[model samples]
Target chain A: MLHRGRIQAQGEDLEESESWAADTPPTWQEGIAMIDKLENKIPKKEADLRREAFEKARSFVTQAGENGGVNAVVQKTIMVKDSKEARVDIEVRKGKAFI
Target chain B: MVQHLFKDFLKNKRIYAENVGYWQSIVSELFAPTQIKAEAYLQTTFANGEPFLDGNPIFHFVVKKLNKAVRIVQEVAESDKLEITAWISNTELDEMEINELVIVLQLSEESKTIALDLIRTWILNDETVKNTKLKIKEINLTEEILAH
Candidate 1:
């Protein structure tokens, strides 16, 4: 689901060893410290592009989810934001229900 | 001059009747939009407590432009009434979007009721809201206080 919020895992299914997230989510101070550390890694221009990509991805997900069901796979990668030709093809699992 | 006085009284009544008809037309003109039906998109997606799916079309218009989703969502969680609390989310929105939404919300008593129900359901059922501490507010839009 394309959700707008600080992304966080909800369930306990993620194994601590496999997951990059801290077992106990960081405090506000720690989160800020982490962002500060990673600030140099992300370019300012790329941030805008990334934000646009996220929004586009969200829209793609929403339309696909509604017309078909939840089961979908990311098919290809393209960089430009305005490509109407850029489509995320959805494979609807008709007989199987995920919920 | 009793006849003259009665004629003057009749003239005054005629003026009053004309003014009443004119004002009644004006009032109906003002309220005409409210009688029109809600947009089909809104009716299908949001009305009647229909499930607010992840990629609902409304999200494309409202939430996509949200520079202040966290703050707005938090305020909604704390609102005494969901729609009233949502009024503040307008601050984050451009004027055009707000105007469009206002028309929808004010269209009819039925639209307002449906919208309020949708807001209440959407907030309570939101997946990201794991914080049990965040209290669910009732439908009271009169008092305006920003919580958080």
Candidate 2:
């Protein structure tokens, strides 16, 4: 499957491991490092455009709220992975967290 | 810039939804799934006022109020009246803008430990300057997430 910048072994491009140095397991860390180096070489606009995509797909946030009748997000967060729609919510009843 | 996007969102959520693929590509560059972690425990600050885990904090706070016959889909739900500080980010092609805002979220609920745990991974984890490598650039919150 297509993941990150590289095609999986199943795709048209080379498998990630093969694309790397003859040695080494070719971890994601290497992928990121390679990206960092490549970023410097790309045009500013292109580099920035690339960065923006990653930022949007991944968001880290928390919310906390107290002194509420039922819903006060004192400190909490809502993360919806691999989707564009919103997916963070909580329902508390009398000091308890439940599904 | 973030505020401007917020206004735009208010005008049309489909604005971004309209061109999801294009928008996704832009945001894709800034984060990788590995960098995007979901583990909350009552605290979170993606960007320190200083970049990459600096003690200094720059927060994008926003507040949203409940509006017009609010409703949701859930078997059980309770709500609280909340005043909030929201933070958000918007990817406009080559430009990435982040901002902090303040708004009120009306119609909320009070929670206890047991129920809170149910949604812990999604919201209540704590990650900040002292913990993760995530930086605090700018935060732009949306009303859709806050509206009661």
Candidate 3:
């Protein structure tokens, strides 16, 4: 399916637009990486900090699962500062990294 | 830029509905069964402004029949340019690599073309970035599912 929309904000609207661009949510890819990091962290001198991190990561994973696994809740709209345009094409074999 | 404006946009139900409606319309034509659901939530961000978990997805498109799927993500790079980043992946248990010739042979090229056109229209029709050229900024495979 194809989707389309134009975000045209003026004086006041521009403020809101910029905000949207700044804090756009992270994609599921990023979320999973975070969960993995939190779950596999070593318990050492920073036990308290580690626990806090665990709670934060657990909340994220729980949230993603509740919404529908990472696959379902994976979409993001962000704004960056760059001016390069190029189309990327990837090939995947059945059981390997990008090839 | 301002905190209140950002807060207002996040809470704006109208714009949220518009986003959901637009994606639903396009995804309906692309997949069978036409069962698409979208929900939005407020995610937390780090001091560096990176998004973290704590919210729901605004729109979810499920591909049941095809092993390959093309996911479109919208990003407004700066204020004038709209950068289109997409992920093309197959529902397999393997990691993929990138080269010159990719999924064009397996996945439906027709669908890819339609997706690009849709993004083009989004930029062309926008009042803010009108007359700007549309280009596909990046296409990559979805990150590998890590063991957690």
Candidate with best DockQ: 3
DockQ of each: 0.02, 0.04, 0.06
Report residue B19 deviation for candidate 2 (angstroms): 7.5
lDDT of 1 by residue, B12-115 (tens): 54643443344234334533554422211121121123333321121212233222221111001111231222222122132132211211111123323443
List, residue by residue over A7-69, the lDDT tens digit for candidate 2: 111111211211222222223344344434544554554444445333321221111111111
Higher TM-score: candidate 2 or 3?
3
Give the i-RMS of model 1 in Å.
13.8
What fraction of the correct interface contacts does each predicted structure contain?
0.00, 0.06, 0.06
Between prediction 1 and prediction 3, which has the larger lDDT? Answer: 3
RMSD of each: 23.0, 21.3, 17.5
Q: Please give the range of 10 consecutive residues that has the lowest summed lDDT in model 1 chain B.
A: B70-79
- TM-score of every prediction relative to native: 0.20, 0.18, 0.31
Off by over 4 Å in 3: A1-99, B1-9, B27-58, B75-78, B92-148
Q: Considering every candidate listed, which one attains the maximal TM-score?
A: 3
On the 0 to 100 scale, the lDDT of residue A78 in model 3 is 26
Tell the DockQ for candidate 3: 0.06
Q: What is the per-residue lDDT of model 2 for residues B96-129, given as tens digits with 9 covering 90 to 100?
A: 2212111112112321111122112212232322
**C-alpha lDDT of residue A88 in model 3:** 14
> Which residue pairs of candidate 3 clash?
A1-B26, A95-B94, A96-B94, A96-B95, A97-B95, A97-B96, A98-B96, A98-B97, A99-B96, A99-B97
Two-way DockQ contest, 1 vs 3, winner: 3
